[model samples]
Target: MSKFKPEPFISCYGGALGAGVDEVGRGPLAGDVVAAAVILDPAAPIAGLADSKKLTERKRELLFVEIQAKALAFCIARASVAEIDRINILQASLLAMTRAVEGLAIQPEHVWVDGNKIPTWRYPAEAVVKGDSRVAAISAASILAKVTRDRELVLLHQQFPDYGFADHKGYPTAVHLAAIEKHGITPHHRQSFGPVKKRLEQLDLF
Candidate 1:
């Protein structure tokens, strides 16, 4: 049997000094855009790793711990709903990613991003589609970003009990849509999202 090789679009970390960047919550009607950059420890082995979307919540939670434990350095950052509304989700996500990379304890020589569009930062980077599933470092980054965003939504549930944030995690589920239709959007809702934007238009609120 032949061993699988990474796709051309997917760039390796190149030795032990590269960073992986990924973001979560870009499509949610609520919650902040969260991003994570991870530098994996040379000795670490994160097996069965894939994109966070392919993993169950239980699996993601488990990997989150292991990744943090094995990472040489990691940083998580967020662009709030207000920021998202001001700059749009894509830019906000990029902003969050840039912030995460900037905040890392050790700077990286190169960065591997998990999407086709690279962030506007001055660092050298390559964006790979589905990179999170192919690159261990990107997978670790996805896990951390997802886990952090999930925790934030869970906390938001406490403040806005009507939204069921703990369960939906700010996704555009029918239940979440119903909640928005009923209770209207909270301050945490992304005002720029179409559904939330329409609701805000009707209510004439910022």
Candidate 2:
């Protein structure tokens, strides 16, 4: 597992204070879409930063705390299921990222966002393809967002054990789809998603 190094990109931007943004839960059928923005302290470097999806849950959980403690600024934000259904997932994701950046304790001079599209915000920003793997700050943001959302799903699981939210984290896996078919949709499920929509239609609730 390769670690992310943001020095190259940071140097390219002339070492300007910058924030890295990333989001999670876009593919999930339930729960909010969560995003995180992190500004790393160059003087205090952290090791083992990598894409959140590539890290184990334990690694992510550990880094999640380290990031908050060492980062110059970090913020986690989310778009509710209702917001996702209203604006569509892509726009909702952008909205969440925007909110995360806006919520940061310290503003950044520039922003590096994971993926090809960025939010329509005032900050000078660049979208990096596979940024979470290439940039340390982006990787930290990814870890924060993923761990935060996964914990929420675990709580949701307690409320609706039949959906198995803890196991799949609201994703439309075989077990999750089967559970939905058996137990019906919950309030947290994203009705706009295909699987959830289909289930809702079958139940004459959509």
Candidate 3:
């Protein structure tokens, strides 16, 4: 998918100037949930835009820069681990998405979210399932959110190399599970998450 021209079919109920939104790190045991909103520019077409999970790190990095340079406007935002614990992952994810949309350099007429659920917001918004793969602007948002979260996790890795955050980006991979088993939980881990909560339970059992 190269350039996505905003069509009436795409925003059947939304206003003009549609902004796509997506979130990353929802399944991670650590790191804040990151979200991004992007309003693509029809005049400046970006090539090779796809779901960020499908793209290699190199491809994502390349597109991350291109998206920022070519898109009409984009914004990345996050909900902290603490917020996730307080409000739960789903709400925190939406909050981050809402924040991302609000931070846009150009206010969008409507927010096109990449999932079945839309956040609580005053503006008009629509949720399209699998939108990251279907919508160009949503794909751009996925790229930015994923790349930004991964970059931040790498920084956290430097401080806590034992968790191998740089390699797994705080996901619940085998290596990460092993690291958690050995090292226990850190402040960075989302205590509200199952694995982290289970780990805390085992510790309390002792």
Q: How high is each candidate's TM-score?
A: 0.92, 0.94, 0.91
lDDT of 3 by residue, 13-116 (tens): 44448899999988999999999999999889899998899899999999999999998999999999999999999999999999999999899888889999
Candidate 3, 100: how far from true, in Å?
0.5
Model 1 off-target regions past 4 Å?
1-13
Residues 108-179 of candidate 2: C-alpha lDDT, one tens digit per residue: 998999999989989988898889988888999999999999999999999998888999998889999999
Evaluated at residue 57, the lDDT of candidate 3 is 97
Cα lDDT listed for each candidate: 0.89, 0.92, 0.91
Q: In terms of TM-score, which candidate is strongest?
A: 2
Q: Which stretches of candidate 3 lie over 4 Å from their true place?
A: 1-9, 13-16
Per-model clash counts, in order, read 0, 0, 0
Arrange candidates, best lDDT first. 2, 3, 1
The best-first sequence of candidates by TM-score reads: 2, 1, 3
Candidate 1 to truth, TM: 0.92
